[model samples]
Target: METILSATGLLTPGVEYGRVAPLADDADPVKAVGAVVPVQTHSLNVGVLTEPGQSFPDTDALITRLRGVAIGVRTADCIPVLLYAPDIEAVAAVHAGWRGTVGDIVGVTVSRLEAMGADAGRIMAHVGIGICGDCFEVGSELAVCFEDAGLGAFVLPGPFTDRLTGEPMDPDRRHIDLRCANVSRLLRRGIPEANISVAPECTRCSEIAPGPCAASVAGSGMTLAVGSEGKSAARSGVRLPSWRRDHGTTRRMLTWIRLREECPS
Candidate 1:
């Protein structure tokens, strides 16, 4: 079971992390490693774990210092963030959607980890695959919410422009940069710039276009129907079961992280 990315570089020497592909649900190996998954409710809740295999309800993030205990979150298009603090031996797995981003879930998670003696400056963060800025079209109101939250730089107005050509697009398509917003939040919390690594893959268009573009996936079954269908990943078009791409597909990608159990020599 090859993962999208091993993410070994994202953490210190003792932690392991990866984002699972959609097809591997039946044989997910992380569960065998004491994976503690939460019942996500798209909120700002963060669960603190003291043991492995414990479940939390309505949580979008999980953090723990327990060794050998893997914590994870499920997602379709929302961002999956993994954090580690080598100094304190702490780890966290976060699920950030538009809702969680606006509420500053990652910031709160960092605060919680700090409460456990972890230093924000030494914390390593990995912002995994999710909707990219250009592909994530949003309503003006939503854009304003991000702006109000001090994330105005990441918002692009309707009639989106081509990142490659700078050409204007549909008059009705405003967009927000979830990744940039999260990274901004991370930096504001004193997580050093060099310590944060963000995956470039966009769950929506990375698979559908040569370059990620929302217009490419707009009306395609790979995304919500443009006009009639509502708004909304994989290679060849989408390797994961994107809720927007699959049009309400129940399937999801599991993002997990664990502090490795010591190997006996």
Candidate 2:
């Protein structure tokens, strides 16, 4: 069955957030939630929404202080980050692919939130599912981009084994941990370590439901062992979509966030 993995519980009381894997031809889930979603260009531009149903072109991040108006980003394998600042009653949804990460999109989002009367120390972040370092093999040029941006630690030496089939990649390929790179950005912006929650699933290897279809779609693979920073091991049998695994599949998982009209005491 189709499902949405919720992270609202990981955030403050007045926030709602989740990631949903839609069927190949399902309608837009953002519309179903009455939220605004940007037309992304894989750029660094962030849209600041002031009203319900607002959208912008070439936007990969979204921020809003409006109550009851949700914001979201669609991704196949890129990381989705949801942020909330209770003190300012503001929220942001960011889509950080490799290019966005190299450009420090999460850092840019946090700075924007801080400018809007938000305290970085009080902001809570939920880093959603994406391609894991083990599965994301890249060329040296892309790896150097992260290294030059001072995120070199998240980039690993290659001679990688495919996370799905355990086959060796080119010895010279490199892997980057997009999730931790963005987490480092959040920490650098002053959000406490305890204020962040990371989704441990790797979209490429996190299989769909168990069945003949799953058997056909997923291969025998080793599970990803996440870091010791309060993260769980990556599990299988969740229905999240992946552009890399599916080879340019149009299906996307929508990660969304909204502020509640009433805060619970």
lDDT of 1 at 109: 98
Candidate RMSDs in Å, in order, are 8.2, 6.1
User: What stretches of model 2 exceed 4 Å from their correct place?
Assistant: 1-9, 208-236
Give the Cα-based TM-score of candidate 2 against the true structure.
Answer: 0.85
C-alpha positional error of residue 130 in candidate 2 after TM-score superposition, expressed in Å: 0.5
The per-residue C-alpha lDDT of model 2 at residue 45 equals: 91
Model 2 residue 169 lDDT score? 76
- By lDDT, the best candidate is 2
Please give, for residues 40-130, the per-residue lDDT of candidate 2 as tens digits.
8889998899966565999999999888777889898899999998889889999999999989899899999888889999999988879
How do all models score by TM-score? 0.80, 0.85
Tens-place lDDT digits, model 1, residues 1-265: 2222333348466777765443433434244323688999998989999865577999999998887777888788898899998888888999999988889999999999998899999999988878777768777899889899888998975566654246665678678889888999899999999999887766665543222223343332222111111122223443554665567667666678877777222
Which residue pairs of candidate 2 clash? none
Model 2 C-alpha RMSD to native: 6.1
